[model samples]
Target: MQLPVEIPGLLNYWIVIVLMMVGFFVVISHGNLVKKIVGLNVFQVSVFVLYITMSKIDGGAAPILDDAIKNYSNPLPHVLILTAIVVGVATTALGLALIVRIRDAYGTIEDDEITNQERDDA
Candidate 1:
């Protein structure tokens, strides 16, 4: 049950996964709120890229229910990804707004400093 070109496909998937993991790790490991936001954006964009890549066939055209084009792809994935992208934008916006609040409240944008400030205040 061996495939002739397993390495190529696996290599692509591996790169995608590695990029995703790296983005997430950067988001979590960053202490600056803005950096975290950038990381999250990277993470989200990576997922979007992966999704769009997966949605494409060897030579499939855009999915439109029209009589002119018969080799159309399934539009569900693209639609779902559009929704996900909207949600991700909203999430990123919320996170940035929270960062603004955090900056105003703590006078700093570093996560550790904010936590320390809160502790000192308490």
Candidate 2:
């Protein structure tokens, strides 16, 4: 049922856009690698929300092969989302591990300090 002058139930995308912007800001504005990974996580979470939202068919049934309604979201998007989630987790883990290693190597987690130390060491 479309409204006379406005679209019905269109409040989800704003959240995604906000999350996307926040993630982008965090990733770009922050100097710490850990903070960067945190931002990346927020960014990935927004993508996950976008994917799940795409999978939800309005007034549609699940993807079960039943004998009733025949509408369901395509499985490929969902599968891809699942795989993406796994990849995001792996990436975060690897990034965090690298940050820990960097902290150990430079004795500081601050990006400026690390760069300055590297210059001094060289």
Candidate 3:
């Protein structure tokens, strides 16, 4: 008995969609700078998963030259994701550092509180 929709085959896509929506919701609904940064990282991870999912091929082998291997998985997406992971780490670190500075100056990381403080000062 076969199901009309193949849940197993499309599981990765479903996961990506869920993660993307979760990340987007967190980023938009939270006012804390640190939470926003974390949300951005989550979103970035979802995109990484998306690319990796798109690159996968069933029964595919590595791109190494071989006489018998007919289908080879493309390595470009994996390589790009590796680079993106490094960049994401760097960006996260920078974002956190800036948040630290903001906290130091304002004594709080909440966006609304910061704006209110600024208005009070002005």
Candidate 4:
């Protein structure tokens, strides 16, 4: 049967939505610090994919001065994504380091357990 809209054209968007939801679910449903970090990374990746997908152009060429190249895709999105990747890596490293410190101090990485310990201490 013919569908209402073209599926192939929007397939990338569907994938991005699915990935975004999965990442969000993982972050919301899990209590483990590492798991949360993983979820965040998944979410970050989905966003990166979204940006890249949106920046794509049909029959587009690199931004270069050429008379034959009438259509030139914007390079800003790619550059921004590259910067974001570096920032994401640094942020992940910092997050993991903080988690390590939290584990050492609380003796657990689970959020509920840490809260319980704090409650008991207080």
Pairs that collide in candidate 2 are: none
- After superposition, candidate 1 runs with Cα above 4 Å error: 1-12, 65-70
Compose the digit string of candidate 1's lDDT tens values, residues 72-114: 6667778888999999989999999998898787899998988
Candidate 1: clashing pairs of residues: none
Cα shift from native, residue 25, model 1 (Å): 1.2
Report how far residue 92 has shifted in candidate 4, in Å.
Answer: 0.7
Residue 33 lDDT in candidate 3? 90
lDDT of 4 by residue, 1-122 (tens): 23476547678899999999999899899999999999988989898888887886766688889998888778889999999999889989999999999999999999999999999999
TM-score per candidate, in order? Answer: 0.79, 0.84, 0.86, 0.84
Ordered from best to worst lDDT, the candidate numbers read 3, 4, 2, 1
For model 3, the run of ten residues with the poorest summed lDDT: 1-10
Residue-level lDDT for 51 in candidate 2 = 80
Candidate that beats the other on lDDT, 2 or 4, i.e. the better one = 4
Residue 93 miss distance in model 2 (angstroms): 1.0
> lDDT of model 2 at residue 57?
67
Q: What is the lDDT of residue 88 in candidate 2?
A: 97
Per-residue C-alpha lDDT of model 3 across residues 20-62, encoded as one tens digit per residue: 9999899999999999999999989998999888887876777
Best by TM-score: 3
Off by over 4 Å in 4: 1-7
